[model samples]
Target: MTMESAKLPDGPMSGLVASAVEYMVDAGQRNVLFLDIMRKRGDQYREHVAQTAPHVLQYAAELVIDGRKLAEPVNYALVRIVPPEGVEIDKNRRPFVVVDPRAGHGPGIGGFKADSEIGVAMKAGHPCYFIGFLPDPMPGQTIERIARAEAIFIEKVISLHPDADGKPCVIGNCQAGWAVMILASLRPELFGPLIIAGAPLAYWAGVHGKYPMRYSGGLLGGSWLTALTSDLGAGKFDGAWLVQNFENQNPSNTLWTKQYNVYSKVDTEADRYLEFERWWGGHVNLNAEEIQFIVDELFVGNNLAAGKIEMSDGRKVDLRNIRSPIVVFCSEGDNITPPQQALHWIPECYADVDEIRAYGQTIVYTVHQTVGHLGIFVSGGVAKKEHAEFSSNIDLIDILPPGLYEATFEAKGEETASSDLVVGHWVMRCEARTLDDIRAMGGNSPEDERRFATAKRVSEINLTAYQKLVQPWVKAMATPQMAEWAHKMHPLRLQYELFSSENPYMATVKSLAEKAAEERKPVSQDNPFLAFQEQMSKQIVHALDSWRDSQEAMSEALFLGIYGSPALQAAVGIDPKSTPSARREMPPEHRAMLEKRISELRSRIEDGGLREAALRALLYIGSARGMVDERSIEALRQIRDEQGGARMTLPEFKMLVREQFFILLLDQGAALAAIPNMLPDDLNVRREAFRAMRRVLSASEDITGEREKRLRQIAGMFGDAVEEGDRESNVAPFDSKAKAS
Candidate 1:
């Protein structure tokens, strides 16, 4: 073996040997340098703290005044975002309310900068309002109470903008995502378009080896620790705990790179880092009840997908009950909330896509190939592109027929020129998604469902026992005095406190820090060590991610192997939603109904006539082909209009056209060539058809991104229609080189 090969053997031993040597070399250096850097960083941190002391003092004073002022107000506020320098309300314009997530963090991320969510809405000339809260919670605030308060808040926004749309478009981020969902479900009439970013919904469902946060509750014996922590805190669950959990998920950044990057790039990165840290470090508390409810019902039980979640009044919080168009933004690279956790909730809640159509719920989801969880909301690049596209196309998304669609944002290449009609810099396509496509993500297996069910049961039993026997004593001891003391001592809260006038050292460093900040200059990007630092940072992140994945895979294997075995399966019992197991247990009558329904659909497929068949086939083919633009759609429409009779009603016309379109695609030779031949020269027609297809897709029962891309290609085939060697003759005269080639 080579020297290198000798140094590193194969299998487990190789990893051990490599790790030991690396650890010995770097660990010693890291131990020495890490302490000195940390001490300096801590000094700098305290110095910055000293500078911000006055602001913290002022904020604390304002909080005291506000708390006293709102002694009798309950949950109500007149939130003014941008006070008019001199701008008047346009009666025709709508209003916007952006609710920032209080997910173990303070508010204002939605409007942290001038070019943020609030900025976009204001730029659109909408009357924008921000729903923010004090760092401290109300004496006894529950999530349900917060949802009701949000509804009331939106109602007030509507009242302010009298001539605008009746309801305001509410945007929720992270934890607030499910809150808005609950609000929309409870008060559907009060909401317009609902936007959820980086939201975790179907928590139980995720990719095989990604997003292991949801698995922790089960592994750690459910949410008993949440209750224990709350009890220890004397009632209020420390939001710092939640923030710490988030930090733990990404150890490399939390432990090293985040602060290191700031120090290394202090000049330019200081302001941005401090701005983000202001929010990131501003952790807020939740009631013990609130945290328990979230962990037990949403995370462990996965009740949202099961449609078992209830409101304070015991009313069910069914996701399908929400009438407004729901927009879900997720990413493949998001480790906290993967696309499966964010988007799969729809399919999990509904039996199939058709059921979604039957319920008249408009659900649209977009999956970015690679963007981290925070990037979904905080990345200016994503905000400019994805958010901008969604903002511009809100009306289009709203008008789509009730169904499920995957919204895709595609940047136009140099070959593609921008049209006068396209508002956004980028172009986009909305296509249907299928149930099977969603199921491919996870949480479908019989064993997986059963394990989750067991978790739910354990949580219920544990929570019930805690509430029955221990809650009274805990509450009795959790007096106002204790809560206040706990808040003052909290590490997250202490950061603010230490930076305020309360610190004896603050006055001394305050002036020096100011001058230092003003004179601050960051390390050069071209510095040799800078590249090494970044490389090291990325390597650490990758190692953490790999470790996380391996842990998840091992956990899943153990759970499935142990609980999924025949003996354990028989002993543990299975959930009704569990596949294979549930399918086997279906009642005779329900089974008959399902079989009959399948047979009926099959019969309808077989008996479909030429026109109907053509339309169906076209829908299928158009779905398979990437028929995104105006040309292909116009051809489909023209065929429909020509074949459609003037006397036909809208429904009849649609049916007839759809039928004919299907038949055209089903016929191999003539129909395929004929469909393209009949299409008008104007690409606008294809574009409209593409839009129509999206609208239809929205109302479709089940469709998927993969299938939609395929359909676009099919439509493109028509646009691509070429006669071999007959191009010079111009016999067809429909010779479009771009399409054909």
Candidate 2:
């Protein structure tokens, strides 16, 4: 071989060396950029912390009512959102108020983005308002005061839109959900329709092995630690502790995956990560009385669902008292607030479906298959779909019959029927449901209930012991300066403070990162080293996840073992062999009210003319399918709009619908027979009412199956004939002999 031939082999080796050197240089630059992003994040956190009232809301807003100025003061305030350019508000439409949860973080997650709860409502032409709070609680503030303040804010919104077609719609996200429920229960007359997203009302309710947060109280010896922590904070609990608990739930994400993703995609991911961190790092404070009541009554004691929570005024907070329609939005993939926690409250509060209707309440709940807890409120996709559908169909939900219903959505496509009727990319349908359906979603057995009850008892004992033993000394030792120092030293805060410019070491990172950005040379996507780096990152995530699983398993086993012991049950004054009671007896006054309402409805069963006849016919047709569709509702709205004469307000419409539903529910055959009497004597009026009913039935699709039979029967009662296509009609003819004269 010649020397030139030998040199050719060196050429390939040198090329490989050059590629490796280039990759290393790019990797070094990326490191600098990543660190700089972290520095900026830290700086953002510091700035957010320093603000008097920091929120992540992307919209400009004007303060409407300050809760601090209410007769009962609180830190919360209600603000009206000013629509951006090109967005118009319809003052005649129902207004919307979005309340963010005050759990750990500062408020604004509901309006964190342009495509959020507030955004969707505004896009749908509703005047929007937001309820947010300051970073610190007022001294001696309590949960009851905050709820009262919210009621005042809602009253203000109602007054602002006196000419609105309906009362204002209220949406509460997470912790705010339960707060809204409490307020609605206390003052249901002030609300129109309520949407609660990712709220946990039944705290002790959860599927075994899936929800770990519920077990934390048990493993930590109940709420004694909560009280201890409050005392240590000088009567104010640092919300960073709550945020830390949330972080601890997912070790892999918190310890590695989150930071690694930003580092790997630093060029594109920095702004998004910093935006989220600004809200995540902004911790707030809650009064000791507030946190204690939350942990004691709602979390550990599980009193809210049972109607055992009495206010300082001696009035009990019973969820059954709420008169407004409630729409519950939960998700299966939410580890923080699982479906069981969100929905089991219904069965806990009401004994059966009949009881639900007895109270004349409409409850519609939707469960997402895969979105996590935060995604329910934070994801743009969810906001555009579920929130949008709810906003556009708020009136439809409000007018639904008093019963249990499950709302589901499907994507709109060419195959979708009545696509024109759908407002956006999805179609919503609500099917009548039962208490048994809610129970089938999975919950604790009698044994599991006993265990939880025992845990609650133990928590009470521990809390009492702590109050008598350790609380006094801790309160005596705690000072404002000491509390402030402890808060600054929290791990969650330390991470931001250390990486920020406040640290002398991070100063050079900005200049280095700028230089790297100016001379950016990114490595190829197919680089072998880059692939290797990704694989290593995956391994790290897997290890951290494994560690988390092990820790959770251990905690679960310990909690169950301790709480499930017969001896422990005996010690806690609970009988291990007895089943836990899940139902509460109806108060006599509520029972009497329901009886009087039923009698009133029965007396009006044979009343009214064209409107009542049309509604009764629609309800009869809808019963055969056991479901309600938005398209049919839109058809009704169109009829009302196009007629442009003697329109019924939403409240009147709701009352008519509910009245007709109860009539049918009381006596289906008698109600059907009375349809002819309810119709006007004029032939043209009768024909128009029948056509309107048919239009609603055929709005979504061609009437077929059981629904078709029911519709034909209705047409026959109207003295009209419906054509059947080359087939013998199975629809039973209306018996003229039984018709009302």
Candidate 3:
């Protein structure tokens, strides 16, 4: 065979020529279609911003309660997140209230689709409400004022749903996570279960090399820039800066990947891309005081979670005041609020497990293996899996005794059926976890903590200096026109304006794109040029990522170099040798103050009636294994739902469990001693309570080992022996207690 024949193969040249021509034309048209849609996407964003920035939310909503109309006016408003067709909400069910982050963008990401937080809640038959804000803050809307307004909103919701099982289950996303936490603390009775997703409470946390956002405050010259920015904005800080900061963290995603994604699959990707961009581009504003307080008190001072923040009315914003069960959802891949930052607050705020248990605080957390910060809230799969599981099982979670737990989720085995559980699939179990487990996740480096401590002092000095020296002059020159012009000129906003039809150059692109679509062709997957194009795009993203990493390393170094110095610590009155960063010694008076309460608890071990005894016994058996699952939670809920005996509200039930658990902890012997009096004189009554108690104990699957022993001890209380240790006791038998009622 000739060499030319070998290279060309034996196929006819016409087929190859035709395929090549087709591929070229397809690639060209596809490229044109991509550009065409890109122009239109830009136009959509422009239009969306012009007419209500958060037009991305697909669910229709109606104003339920306006905060401005309240006695204390604020920008926040409570709106009922009306579900889409095919989903029905029950008013008698526990309400689910979702609060979107106000970090930069406008609201509505939570209900961005049918498969979002709101969607999952609605699908679970939860009455849903959304706490949203306006683009412009009220003249003087402080964070405290907003929290009060939200509390009022929650009050309104609760009053509207008197027949509901319990208070609303509040879910806060990102910045809103901390905001709702603040609300929960101020008005703990207003909530049932609190879910904080990707919320960074411990601002100064994370492992140095792995997480970089923690270094931002120090690297940006402490938080004086925040004050300066607000001043320059004529007392209103533009939210665009915060959005720009997020974009700067991952330029690959911001500058290239987002646009490139739409460019590559323009035909299919435009709607989704534009939908997200609408929410992303809708920037909001913060009053100078609001932004300044966030920067000075949170990011810079890190005081809220520390229990040091004093509210306007002199009430301390202590996290311990949050009585609602808190479920923290975070991710390892979340650069914005990494697991370290999200989870470390527990360790910082509480000395140990004993302290957490002492307060009867139910804290449950789950860390996603690889989802990013945004994915925690925005990903549909997460809504279906994690959130679905959460919403469905919140009732079970509410009844759990106060303690720390790590929520474990796993796909059900093949034998599992759709009818067996909530969401018909995933199995969730809460296993007890220790503070050590969280600290092991790089909770807070001693060195880094000290650096933040030093930075906090430096921040105060710089902020005061800025207010006195830089503020007056900047405020004098800054005007309403300049602020308006500056807001319009943001790079992110300008990009959209440049590509929309508002710019004359983009006028023909949409029409041309539509024309090309009629004759559109798509390139074959193996086309050499297409392959090359993908490789080049990957290289661009990779280079940008590498540059980002380098910048992160540089920022961390600069932060530590200035703030980590012994000199700086000394200058700031920090004696690292004597004073630890977060583990400072409790003042003698403070310790003494709690001692009385502790002593009272220790002394008052034997107390309460049948309700206390039953609740105590339930907690004792379930917690003996230090892990719990909802295998029998359905029965438990049915039991709670049933109007049998003295019906306990969720809070009352929780209190009984807590009071009993603490009593048991203080003096198990005394608790046992008090048990006989706790039960009824009637054997039939005792029998019924015993049967109910056993049902509760058997809810968890792990009824072995220590649990087996506890079960035997508890079974004895039924006045019958199930095993050797289960000797008949003062309590009546199961049949008698249950049958009597």
TM-score of each: 0.68, 0.96, 0.90
Q: Which model is ahead, 1 or 2, in terms of TM-score?
A: 2
**Which pairs of residues have clashing backbones in candidate 2?**
none
Model 2 CA deviation exceeding 4 Å by range: 1-16, 720-741
Task: Tell me the number of clashing residue pairs for each predicted model.
Answer: 54, 0, 10
**Candidate 3 lDDT over residue span 184-257, tens digit each:** 88888888999999998988878878677777787777788998888779899999999988888788998899
Q: After superposition, how far is residue 616 of candidate 1 from its true place, in Å?
A: 16
Sort order, TM-score high to low: 2, 3, 1
lDDT of 3 at 434: 87
* Residue-by-residue lDDT tens digits, candidate 2, 136-252: 998769999998888889999999998998998999999999999999999999999999999999998887677889988888888999998898889999999999988999999
lDDT head-to-head 1 vs 2, winner: 2
Residue 708, model 3: Cα distance from true site in angstroms: 2.0
TM-score of candidate 3 relative to the true fold: 0.90
* Decreasing lDDT order of the candidates: 2, 3, 1
- lDDT values of the candidates? 0.61, 0.88, 0.79
Tens-place lDDT per residue, model 1, 256-369, is 678667555443465566556655666666777778789888888777756678876889887777877798998888988888789877766677765665455678888888
